[model samples]
Target: MSEQLITPWAESRPLPPYKGVLAVDAKDFTGLPAVLHAPVSQMIPELVDQAMARAGLTSVLQDKRFPANTGDGIVFGFDPAHLPFVIWPFLKELDEVLAQYNLSVGPRIRLRASVHVGPLPDEGRPDDGNGTPRNDTHRLLDSRPVKAVLASSSEQTTHLAAILSDRVYEDVVLGGYAGLHPDRCIEVPATVEGKPFAQRAWLFIPSPSGNLFRAGVLAAEAPGGPAEPADAPAQRSGRSYRGNTQNVREGTAVMGDVSGNVSHTSGDTRYTATNQHWGSGDNVSGTKNTAAPGEQR
Candidate 1:
């Protein structure tokens, strides 16, 4: 017999309209050293699916595609009400999943989530055949608290740190274009077992080929000290990319894409030093030429 499809309680049953949007970004996936890239990419969607299931929320993985340089990735929508109970715990699951692949979550692979609450249009495309909302409408499925959780960008900050770490290899990179917001990075402090840990951030790399890849923490500072002028690909970095956003400032490392779109921004910086250490050709440990299952290389 075929397995029964599980529907979210919110979908199957009548529910009040929710009031927030939760945007999630996988942590340091792009900067993962080859050893960790495949596994993290594979697990991210699964963990997200599991969180949605546990939250009794309905969601659909959208059709948006990342740029060519990025690795296998997934982006789905979820209800905001499930933030604390479902989303956050689901992110924590990364620790165990990474271990199975001989990887650790580290301060790097943590995720970043942004939540926004406002008037959302009711009419939009359907995300699933089940008659669920699509596009930005799905964002309304979350609650205020859930929205707050997402806006906190906690997990995103952690992921950003790992992205900034040169030791980590990324399967995807985003935002490094000439006319976009370069500060696509988010910064946040993290703790483990009651101990203070590292801060995290992210970077958006916009390839000239029109593909967008996101690097976590390691992305901000290139592996070597400030890139040499001759070696510098004509990429732009700084707050000016953000346009008129007053929140951004100089020395912000915030940059823009070729078309001048705003990326993301935050204030974490631990991955800079750590990644430089690992990616500096000193620790070339791990299986080489081993691509993750279902990946091209």
Candidate 2:
């Protein structure tokens, strides 16, 4: 047999802090025996590359750390701005790939993904590095909210659950352009080994209706806490974090004689139906007539 040689990274520059760190682990992969590891290890990189390319982010997977044959997952440190279009869409495609694999085989190769933004410390290995942010991202995969969402999705058509750190939510998803609704995300505390890791990470699942997963409304506590109260008000409109709402149907006021009115607000102003009359006490401004009765405005 010939002697083997190992190559190093062409650019061994010091690893810098990344604005967003993505960590993903195959759920229940450890329970498999050694023989099964090789297939998963070999397939993951290809799957990741394909998914990233599909999302038009082919470069994001280039320098990232992928799991070895015995390892359990992959880690990526990238620009925070990519979270909305690049990373989020990549995850959606990734889920499709994994779900297809499950359909091809008998068992599902579900993935639990977590995203966080922070400084990353160099581990001296360009290929694989670990730091506080990466660890927190991994620990977030073990969070109760993530696990619960994953379990809930098992019976559904999709088998992926993504958890976003508070910073990612506030800065990216909440900032806009993610194509995801804030109401679809629920704040959940991320805990690992019975200790709190992230105080208010957001959890989301692609909806089974061929849309993003539904996280439903969540309570204000860590995993295994009390359920949402019965009196919690339901969201009547499909309003994203900072997006505009277009009312298509007439809204009925319970106690007032305002009749039925449809209203929508985009920025700094509110527009209502012309048929409806609003009093000064209603505090509504900029009423414009864009639609007739029973027509979307």
Candidate 3:
């Protein structure tokens, strides 16, 4: 039940918006088996190096592990747009290579991306160690618009990934506990051989980091309506709302016997007997002696 923590990848570094350009927070990794709880700390660094080498991007990155307060692990970050197009192919290749180690990419190891078109901030060089610049308020203000966009993108990607991946993949989306919101979400139905698949869709959550978490799977179904009304009578019994008695015959009262047998009785005399168990057998009984005038029977 780990959740992801959201923090600025770089402190005091201004990020500006660019059209058709994306920023991604990516981590390099080889797959590890589920039984191994502690993975090599060098795994992320090695992956990053491999990505940089393949993309031919000459950039310096800090080698520090930012530990979570809860002691889960640390998160690494990089600028995706700074890397060459080969970055994507490199990751795919890494996945194939790691398969040999009986490890692949960790499910939780994903990139959050953000794409925006806007102006970037420009940082000035330091002066003669005097009052050069107390703070880069200019860059901070300029990067605000773009930074906000990227933050939103990361949230959307995380949410979509959570919904699409299998239940086991929850570890990835949940992160180490800081819940994020998803915006600009899109769900597309999945198909096989040009035919629709039942309860399946493709989700897209574009992060400012230029990272897109993609997966294919079945979608969750909506629950059915409430349970049927409990007042419904049993189907086996042919009794109506007025009880088992079908048609009224004079002043007879429809009585149900111990075995649920229905019969008609007028006063102290049984007129007809109908045994439902015997398939509708009716027996005519003797009628009560009619009392003379007002005399009681």
Clashes of each: 69, 5, 24
- Which residue ranges in model 1 land beyond 4 Å of their true spot? 1-19, 31-42, 51-75, 91-110, 122-297
Q: Per-prediction TM-score, please? A: 0.28, 0.60, 0.24
Q: For residues 74-124, could you state the per-residue lDDT of candidate 2 as single tens digits?
A: 666776667786436877888787767767754457777888877665454
Tens-digit lDDT track of model 1 for 1-297: 966876776466444343333344453455667887776666655654554554434432232112111243443333433333322333333333333333443423444333222233333434221122222222221222122223333432222111221111121112222122223332221212222333222222211011111211222344544332333435433212212121211112222222222222235411221211111111111112333354321
Q: lDDT of all the models against the reference?
A: 0.30, 0.58, 0.27
lDDT of 3 at 56: 45
Whole-model lDDT, candidate 2?
Answer: 0.58
Error (Å) of candidate 2 at residue 205 is: 0.6
Clashing pairs in 2: 205-213, 206-212, 206-213, 207-212, 207-213
Model 2: residues >4 Å from true position, as ranges?
1-16, 65-70, 122-129, 196-198, 208-297
Ranking by TM-score: 2, 1, 3
Q: Any idea what lDDT model 1 has?
A: 0.30
Tens-digit lDDT track of model 3 for 1-297:
755743766456544422112223322222445444344443433554554455443342332111111112222223324322322333333333333322444444443222212233223223211110111111221222222222333432332121121111122223321122112222221112222221221132222122321111111123463222234346524422322222222322222212333344545533233221110112122232333354321
Question: Which one wins on lDDT?
Answer: 2
Q: Could you tell which candidate, 2 or 3, scores higher by TM-score?
A: 2
